[model samples]
Target: MSNYVIQADQQLLDALRAHYEGALSDRLPAGALFAVKRPDVVITAYRSGKVLFQGKAAEQEAAKWISGASASNETADHQPSALAAHQLGSLSAIGSDEVGTGDYFGPIVVAAAYVDRPHIAKIAALGVKDSKQLNDEAIKRIAPAIMETVPHAVTVLDNPQYNRWQRSGMPQTKMKALLHNRTLVKLVDAIAPAEPEAIIIDEFLKRDSYFRYLSDEDRIIRERVHCLPKAESVHVSVAAASIIARYVFLEEMEQLSRAVGLLLPKGAGAIVDEAAARIIRARGEEMLETCAKLHFANTKKALAIAKRRK
Candidate 1:
């Protein structure tokens, strides 16, 4: 797919809106004046006097309104870095994000989602946002909606597996990189024969470091991969992935809570330490291997708290 962005005056915006008025769609992106779907392109005009043309025939459609010299066609194949930096939201792409990494309990869940320009409105209508901005109930409600609307894949690294890998000298960042890669690969395969304009991963590490960690892995997917910080805000696909991953993380936490007969608190805070101590008392230290990332400082803190109570 191709993506092009052009600056348009109010007159041109009105003209374009009028031209595609019959094809207009609802649930426009925030600050968007109007959006329309055409056979060859999805056109979105924003309040900032910017018009985006995206899809296989984006260039052709954009050409109709602007001259060859005035048009700023930022095709993915021609200027990969520039395209990723500026117009990621305008392109049809796959985006991946992870959750539960900072939490002391539950597995780390990474999810990848594919979103084209055509589905942006639908995704936005699902109320997708950064998972951090939403609470558990909101995530639970929105996640399924996004799952139904987009092609997405999620990978969960349970506590036992996470602990095993951490003990084997693997860094948490490396584990995240692997999980992100796994979900991206799965989604790409799930949507086989239809390549996206790009693959965007919520930036956890520098681009070089991320791939360097995955260098030993077989079948790594690197083409069109852009690591951007705060990516969930850049594209609806990343936000959808974030919400889904967070929902799964919350569900897993519930299961672990039931298994331990105590609520597993989130984060590596004092509350988590208290909960961990309770788990140790009710079950044993080994129980955490199944439900909590043992390498976190909370482990030591919980142990100290448990010993003090005993």
Candidate 2:
């Protein structure tokens, strides 16, 4: 069997041991490279190709033989998952997420978080995950915590501005994709001095379409942008971004509601229609466009209902 040497931070090494010991994934992939946890030092190892052993016996054997005589203190800034995998050397990883896309009101906000070989656990422990899986209060509480742990950037596209752009001939989907890409670009630019190795985005479209759209804008992502579904669950940085985006959107919505003197509802559903109608009655139809995304079908419906009641 061929052997390979892999280096990793202590937490990742401990995670590797936990995975092999059935405390993590039940089936450890063959040829897995991982770190083993010791009191003051971490031991790194590689398993021979994708073989699933019956139990933890092989892991124990490998752990015992792989022990090195020299031990060093764990680096304070080492994060396991953010570390570049074996063949990649050291590289930075980033995660991106957006909010307010489906809402009839409020601005579309996209956020990106840069995570390196340190601070992954602190983010995960703060309950950062998919924003859809969280409530507004929870997101608000966790967003600042995530920001404290990692550097991030955001882009907000307010409704009136978005409508003006759309009326000028931008397709809704294209506009959204463009805004998301621009946000990504801004984040990349902000972190360019650091030169991260890769970036991850929650995939909004098929790969070819996304790449083509980005290419049209002359914003080539250099094949290092990974777009995957449910990425936030697998990547802590993306989860942190998701929380930030959601928190910002929630806050913006609240402010918009106060500005218009009516409770603005979430989403483009029937409840939102009711809220829009109430706002129009309390204020005026002309003011509705300012507080809501006029491009939504719900906007036309609300206008029609308002006219009928008048």
Candidate 2 C-alpha lDDT tens digits along 51-128: 222222222223232233222212231212221222121235688888888889888888888877567666767877
Name the top TM-score candidate: 1
lDDT of candidate 1 over 1-310, digit per residue (tens): 6787878888888889888889998979999999998787899999988889998656445645663223465753432333423366877899999989899999999999999989988898888899999988898888888999899999999999999999999999999999998888899999989999889889887666788899988878888787777888778899999999998888898999999999888888999999999889879999999999898999999999999999
Q: What residue pairs are clashing in model 2? A: 13-35, 30-49, 30-50, 30-51, 31-49, 78-117, 79-117
> Which whole-number lDDT from 0 to 100 does residue 235 have in model 2?
69
Residue 218, candidate 1: C-alpha displacement in angstroms: 1.1
Q: Count the backbone clashes (under 3 Å) in each candidate.
A: 0, 7
User: Each candidate: what lDDT?
Assistant: 0.85, 0.65
